[model samples]
Target chain A: MNDQRPRILLADDEKAITSNLAPFLERGGFSVTVAADGQAALDGIAALHPDLVILDVLMPRLDGREVLRRLRRAGNWIPVILLTQVGEAAERALALEEGADDYLNKPFDPSELVARIRSVLRRVTPGQPPLASAWQLACPPEAPGQPALALDRRSRRVSLDGRTLDLTPKAVALLEYMLTHPGELLSRERLLDAVWGWDYPAGTRTVDTRMAELRRALGDDPARPRFIETLPGEGYRFVARVVAA
Target chain B: MKITWRDLLLAALPAALAGVAATVLRLSLGRLAVLLLRADIGTALVLLGSSLSLFLLVYLGARRAGIARSRAAIERHDRESGEARRRFIHRLDHELKNPLTALRAALANLQLALSESDRAQRVGDVRLQAERIGRLVADLRKLSELEERPIEQLPVDLPGLLEEVVEAARSNPAYAGRELRLVVSQVPWKLPPAVGDRDLLALAFYNLVENALKFTKAHDPVEVRASEDGRALIVEVADRGPGIPAEDQPRIFEELYRGANARGFEGSGLGLSLVRMIVARHAGSVSVRSRPGQGTVFTVRLPFDARDRAPVPAAG
Candidate 1:
């Protein structure tokens, strides 16, 4: 692997997956190191110290989950991305809790995996702290007079007027993306691509339905303006004034 | 066998002798002793013994005559009740099927008589009603079948089954504008044959997937997915529609039941019943988890195979 280019350690038991991903990541301008199994990936990690590691959940000789547990236990805060075979939320949360930086489900689009890798790499560079740790992923901070919206990154929860909002998984993803890019008028297409994986259709009513659900969850009147403002022809924008915490 | 004077005299001799002895003893004893052994007590005791003997003799003769007749009557009654139950179910099944079959025939005839302009509308209505009948017949058959037979199964590829169901649903205009997605791991390995009756399993999955697509709004994607969890294969049909009401979850799988929100929706209320029957026949179980408006997930778990009784090792 080249020293200057960001190195990603890819570990999956299946050769086809790693092989398929190699060209895709190389095209995206990243140095890729492939490991056939979990133990090999961990050994490579200790030696090579790659910028990111994408681990598969099912593998012989130290499974992905155990690998993650050990790495985190060793205080190696190397950003890790878990590859899940099933898109089960509980399993994904378990991986995240075990110190995985992010995860992508199998049969995932190459572009989406690369995007997540970039997102994690951008957050946890050596010189800088993780942006997700510094800022709330779901909502802005709402102290005494700070802001109307407060987001709790660790919990993936949002709050308004001191009341917590219960949002679904997809709703949280969309909200997190919106919070990361505050004040930009994000088009529906762009928002769909960024939040929902690239595999989802571009023009889908799912976004509209979810936004309606989000508005309902946020206690905002759909007919009137509140935290989220609809741009009519444009997409939704988070317009609440941020009060400094 | 003929009674003679000599035999009568012999029978009376013992009683006469005992009477004489009692008289002598009464005379010889003192008044206090005679009073203590009262004369009426002996006579009452003799009468009580004779009556008990007579009662036993009469009872045994009557029991011998009545037992066989009573046993036959009870057995006949039991057989009659069982026959009645069978006849009732048979009649109900036949009665329920007759009108639907008649309507289907009528529709077919109408289709022949009608020209191209009205043919499409008539044919579509016919198909919808025919499906309703098919669902009803399936329910009745399942209700009866599950009571008697277990699944006789061959290996079924679930993905292939799902593809056929989705294709069938798509062709129906009622499912227009909805996106149906079949999401499975690309592992490409087939599930160990879940020994299950193919026709019954197909009906169950078709009902679940079709129902999911129907409840969802236009253009909303309904996802059907399968995955291995331990030794069980879990197949789920999930809909992002207004989910079943919480109060209805426990009872939705019941026969001829529809949730309060489902009252106005177009359904026969037999879809879930048929699904449950089929699952039960395959030695499997089904459950639903949902909150109103969040969407619902119906999960079915079937054993992997006979030899693999132990739970499949959890994903390493």
Candidate 2:
């Protein structure tokens, strides 16, 4: 069994908050790094290259927004979740638009943050296959006169109707998971954990975006989905009969 | 009594008009002069009486109108001020009661048989409540002093005072994540000394900065800028946060008048009122410009002491 754990960078200027939260996160199976201020947070991100970053919107020196802005500008797409105060809906919206993975208001239950972390990790981290045999069984040979979707696990590629789809690795991983599951009603959390990894803190909006991108690539409509069927608030379903090619 | 020429003219004008009317009637009826004169005289007398009555009526009406207008203005002012005083009292009671209740509850809880950690936490709560009460009382006292007491004017170093206030705010744990920056120009220009009590002015600046921090995000920078505008020193505290709503701006300086957006935030609402009071005492003015989404800028302008005319050089 692998002993590796996902690394989380927790940035807040409040010492009391970090001191209290870091241990809880560590107990939840994450290796946590604490940054005292915005500048420290940015420096930590550069040095640590952590799997996920939890940022407080208000921090001394650079602040969370500036840090996020710099990170995005530098093309660092590490999963980020913002910790904001209550009644900051406008700021929360701005954060999301600026590519923040998710946001949680302060005075939140620690358990809720842990749950979000798990869900986000699942969506962001590409889960490792257990065995080579399991990889081979991921997709089987295609049947005659059927529209088929094939996933080449080795190449991290997905092909539909013998035509290669230009998909990001994350998108391909998502497609592979949905195809493998077939008729199962996969919840967003399940998809997030299964495809992204166990500890990613990306929100359902992230899942929604990836789903939209995948649908566009597969030439599927959300209103009348051919392959990916959205269950609105519940989750998504792959209705297409995917055969092994 | 000494009558002026104007008063004599006013008295004679009616009689003159009556005489002129009588002459016209007598001339028109030349053959029947005596009978026409008698009738014309009677007509003139009636006309004079009516004209005098009308003049008196207009003069009295004009005086009454003037009195009524002033009376209405006085009554309106009294009503408004009375309502304002009532609101101030009501808010004071409410604000004071909150901490008092908390303190009582904490005291009661302290009598319970609890663990060491729980007892310590309860003690902390009690201390916090006590501190809140102290702050409320202190603010009320300061507000009254600012309103009633005469400010002891001195040549105050505007930049130094602001730096001290900002530094104090930066060190406060409550404002831990917020950035407090003093925005200065590349040219190190000297700022004229504002004529005010140093301690009171510092308190005003501190309150403004603290208020800014309360509204702004922890990461947002609260910039304090000071410049000389001729004879006045203009100090502005700007924040990048959700601004005061249009409707809230006018009444924000009123005692205990909180804004619509101030619901979730913790404040006594006495800060700005105190600032306004202090500035007014120093013969200065404070105003705010804010838009809903953009941000807020609170500008305080105080006159420089004419006695200290020499521009003091900026300390390196």
Candidate 3:
């Protein structure tokens, strides 16, 4: 079961699909392991240590996204390609930005998938580019009051003036939303809905907790805030001139 | 059916009260005419005049209530059907796109084929996927036509139809080693013949049984049972397979809408929806009941044509 070909864990619920894709990938010189569901995909990744894994978003038991999120949260940097059903550009970019190597829309040619897999495996090889499947997101400080910050969406690495800063996924999501909607008067309730979702167990406390961590990670003093400005009765606001990254 | 009961209550209760009120008003007016003014001949005329007016009042009130109830039902039906149409269009893309993708992959393989046999195999793969897309388009057309085509109002033997569909299901390759049971029982009477186009009815029943076979495991028994409740012949195809999720169950019969749990199985997502349109054309309704991890049973009730009340001769 082990060989020189790039090992791929192909996770899709469709039997017809796995039968077709498995042979195509094998012919292209990659060892393929077909996982019928999301749980099997995770277990396959652990046991096989495949070079790359292709995940379908809609599967039984666990979806591809939960699998991707869990893997990233556990700090596993294995290159992953997501097979997304959505054709929207922004959603595809978001999937790529979700710490995945790349995204291919469903019903795509197998060769296109093979090309993506080969490219991803090459990037993860030693002596290649530093961030594998990474997208560099920099906020341009075009105006005098604009903030100078850069955040890597794929890697979740925040940088202030060329200095890299570490942040959790939650804090990154909070900062990402605020950065995109600069100067908007965002209430705590609004932030919670946008970032943590209404179904999230924690109350407004999670918002304050993540904000505190964001400020700490960025080394910003709440008393004299540089980016996140908190009002006494109101909510937090990004006090910087910004443009869409 | 529940709505029908509610509507009946809405109309009947109000009409009954109006009838009592009309009686009281007639007696009061007759007494007032005779006692208050001492006019007997005029009292008879007054009573005669108020009867028609009171009848009109009650008739108009009941009619209005019926109209209101019908309006609400139509609004709800339109809303839900519109939603189903929207989902059908949404899923239409994925259903076509996946097969086309595979077809393209096969074509790509054909170009890379090294030997004659390899080339032939690739060509076969291409044909298979292309045929799949063709079948999907054909099924869609058949369903749309079924919607427009006038159904033949001929007597359809309910028990005979079930046996035909069940036998056909037994012969299917997928039904190998699987048990499909068909039971027809009409308490105190033989099964009544349903009224519809006979071929279409058969297709609908066959699709239901096929769906059961598709979802259940190879060894699971798929049962088709037909019974009559005086007004309709109720046929159910029950399978001991993975039950549909509560959310997906409602939309499963919508054209091209596949359940999340059923994505692993290859399908055009047209079978159940086609069954829906067919049964609907025959003046019948279909419903599903399922519990996740336990099993699912699809029930189709075809109302026996009211005019055709005679039960079919019992079959051995």
Candidate 4:
């Protein structure tokens, strides 16, 4: 294992940003590799197993969100910094819940990007136990027949109360995040940074758009929400009490 | 459908003329001869003349009536158009109010937060609010320009125009709060020297850059770059952030169409609309390519021929 320099994988479709950022990170004393899209980033990460991964939220042939999911599923504990554009607060929260270390919004200063990369790297470096001890705790699977979450990994299908629910990829990701947090209040900005990744070029209304869709799929009303509740000037929280079967 | 005063006058004209003419004719002919002729051809001639005179009078009355109705129709159309204009003005005023209100609030917050260490933080709030107002103003300007004098054909120095635009955008009161980076690529530049009015074209590019920077988060660097692609000059402003939704791509440049993702982002939703209008005015075009989770790339293509050169005054 090369301990001389921390290796970071930076992936984005834009050549200018990627090229400009690579040198900036190198100046910050981090070894960086540029990937054009999500799949390429994933392939690069698999080959390199870098100390940190900086991924753009939007990409072709599989988005950043899906790539992050695969990374978690593979049990790769590599610290990641997701870049999102505006309006991705809710999505950012989902990424955090899925175990991403940090995130940033696009048009971000190269210096700040380096700073955040350092922050995440410091938290989860090799031979150093991560600072947040809660993440280290192994969670037991849910008990049987107690509000069971029947998720079919192959079909991307979900059901609650014997009724099938059709939710968008982003909404499903949010639900999964909320389920993991279970009663924790998630701010809109934080959520956006989590799911969408930094530089997910949008405004705050992306959360509202995906939330509205989620509510429609879950048979929840915005005026009188059952599962997801608003925090009033802060963000949203998933309030449902569940015990997996 | 209601009857007018002209209709009444038309109805009365024929009868009035016929009564006066008949009385005069009766006075000319003596009663004895008239009584003898009344039994023969004289009576037939008088009856025929009276009927023919009445027919002519009725025809004149009907023509006058038709003219009157048409005049009323024109008046009605004018009134409808006036109302429509008033409604449009009302809508414009309503749109203008939101940004102004936000700007006021942001300024107030800045004044309050001045003593604190987070004054720098509050600066962003103030700047964002101001951007909201700037966007609204840009939208209004665009509406007025497109409606009034439209630019048709003019040569443009793409690089010079871009530089001026970036400078204007960065200097804007709303945008002065953030760090702005303008990158220009050096190539054998081909530009028609005597392009359009530097002011109007500069304003168009300024609006586009302002939008890119406005939509970006604070503390982040907003990028402005220009490069020539084949026969077209391509200017792009790309941010590394959450991009616009696929559904909104088509409508982003439409007047008054705010995307679902733009809530809490200070904008009157007219920046892109204005950009399109200005580009179209110069015989150029603008387009957006975006993905939901990725950033957006806004492209402005201005066609130019190096041979067409005219020395126009630079913008003051």
Whole-model alpha-carbon lDDT for candidate 3: 0.74
Would you estimate the TM-scores of all the predictions? 0.39, 0.45, 0.44, 0.32
Which portions of model 2 miss their true places by more than 4 Å?
A1-245, B1-57, B184-189, B308-316
Candidate 2 residue-pair clash tally? 20
Scored against the native two-chain complex, candidate 3 gets a DockQ of 0.01
lDDT for each residue of candidate 1 in B1-316, tens digit (9 for 90 to 100): 2355754554455445555555544444444355446765665555555555555555554454456445655676788677756755664565456547767776877758657766776666776666556546545544664556434455666676667666667767887667888887546455555666544566688788888877778866788888776668889999888898889898788666667877657655667876887787788899999878779899998877675343457576
TM-score of chain A of each: 0.67, 0.51, 0.52, 0.51
Q: What lDDT does candidate 2 reach at residue B15? A: 57
- Residues B1-316, model 3: lDDT tens digits: 2367777788687779687867867777767666557656666667666766777777788778888878878887898788767877778887888889999999999999999999999999998897688668757766765677555677778787677667667766767778889988856778878887655677778877887888878877888989876557899989898889999987788788878877878666788888899889988899999999888999998888778775555554
Give the proportion of true interface contacts each model preserves, from 0 to 1. 0.00, 0.00, 0.00, 0.00
Instruction: Compose the digit string of candidate 4's lDDT tens values, residues A123-218.
Output: 455633222212222122244543334444224456765556876555665665555444556666556555543111222445665677687777
* TM-score values for chain B across all models: 0.56, 0.75, 0.73, 0.52
| Span of ten consecutive residues with least summed lDDT in model 1 chain B | B24-33
Interface RMSD of each: 16.4, 24.0, 25.2, 16.1
Superposition TM-score, candidate 4 onto the true structure: 0.32
Q: Candidate 2 falls in which docking quality class?
A: incorrect
What C-alpha lDDT, on a 0 to 100 scale, does residue A38 get in candidate 3?
96
For A1-245, candidate 2 gives per-residue lDDT tens digits of 87589999999999998999999999999999999999999999889889889998889898897888788777677877777531122332354346555556554558768876775665453322212113322333245654556677556667767788887655776786676555657778667544432211223444776787798887787887767898878899877754433
